[model samples]
Target: MSPTLRSIVCGVLGLTLSAAGSTAAAAATTIAGEAAPACVQYTAGWRYTFVSNGCDTVQQVTVEYRDGTAVPCRTAAPGETVTFPGYGTSGNEVLGVVLCGTTPA
Candidate 1:
């Protein structure tokens, strides 16, 4: 991903982090970290996962997060694992977006 795109993503992720704070706290996560690919707003808390395809500019990744709950991310492929920790259903919340790619695109 270009530096500009990375920055934009990070900026947006920052906002998402801020917005998720209260919810994270309520869920006992407290927004403790930000996944890398480093440039998007697809962030999650301790008990959450957010993913994105930073390298694929045209490839949009659409992650599914319901009520901010982790969606059993094990199905995530290699590059897909980055931007978010979609390691699978953990009872924790999951939040992220995917666009483009045919599969986890």
Candidate 2:
């Protein structure tokens, strides 16, 4: 598998397992920022609400998992409401998300 894909998978699996009830990592669970911090995973898919921004703005997203799997995603438009199910199992604090432009210059 590619390095990016591997990273995302590892991160997702790690989060999923911990969310189910891992006592050693109680402080690892995290959801940060306001107004759609781009690249945040639905790992465990909690009922999270955020103000949509840059609607109709096409964008690409790359997420790196704890184990180094990188998952790539994109939006057709800015400020779009996307529902990505099975994003990952929410079992710990989210590390971070990285966003990139969807279109080429």
Listed in order, each prediction's TM-score against the native is 0.22, 0.33
Model 2: ten consecutive residues of lowest lDDT:
26-35
lDDT of 1 by residue, 8-66 (tens): 99999999998797555433422223333444346666544555444544333444555
Identify the leading candidate in terms of lDDT.
1
Per-residue lDDT of 1-105 in model 2, one digit per residue for the tens?
999999999999999888665542322332222323543333324342222335345544433345543333434355454433223455423344445433331
Query: What's model 2's lDDT at 47?
Result: 40
Q: Give the residue spans of candidate 1 off by over 4 A.
A: 26-105
lDDT of 2: 0.42
Cα lDDT, all candidates: 0.47, 0.42
